[model samples]
Target: MAAARDRGVRLGRPPAALPEGAPRAAELRAAGNSLAQIAAALNAEQVATPSGRGQWTKSSVQYVLTRYDQERADDG
Candidate 1:
């Protein structure tokens, strides 16, 4: 959902799930790769938080993986 304000637009929810590095984490995890490896990949890719500041963390990786895992589990 979106709303128009005097300043412009505002989002009701986050634009997307996780962050840019999220897909890398999921891809590596699905390939049986390590979290550290995923972190390195994200760092190399310059993925950051929603604020566009700071690097991706291990917890973020875990968060994405867990969300994806749970979603798939729920889908079946």
Candidate 2:
């Protein structure tokens, strides 16, 4: 873990809601959608992970959205 961190790699399962829903997640979050709402929206839209699973939990959405926010922060 320390070695990965030293290499700027985030250790853990990569977020499922990223790259695709990431932009939409930020938009929804900015528009005041709760984590549950965001998850529901993604599920309702039939979005799936790269593995083709459509299951989306609130925590998964939160993880993606939080990572998006952090990356945006780092960008500026």
Candidate 3:
């Protein structure tokens, strides 16, 4: 581990990156959109999901919102 660190190798899994639509999703939610509505809007806009596959679902939107919130909190 020390040798790898000295060689500039990163340890452990990479940090999670927010999806491209994450901020938009958070904004929509802040604008009082329901989870389903947010999902529909995202799908209509053809935004890529975190997985880069499949359409946005209410659950997925909620997950992204939660993660986005966590990231914001951490940053602040």
Compute the lDDT for candidate 1: 0.69
TM-scores of the candidates in the order shown: 0.58, 0.69, 0.79
Off by over 4 Å in 3: 1-15
lDDT of candidates 1 onward, in order: 0.69, 0.78, 0.95
Off by over 4 Å in 2: 1-17, 50-52
The candidates, ranked best first by TM-score, are 3, 2, 1
Show the lowest summed lDDT stretch of 10 residues, model 3.
10-19
The best-first sequence of candidates by lDDT reads 3, 2, 1
Comparing 2 and 3 on lDDT, the stronger one: 3
Backbone clash numbers for all candidates listed:
0, 0, 0
* Candidate with more favorable, higher lDDT: 1 or 2: 2
Worst 10 residues of 1 by lDDT: 14-23
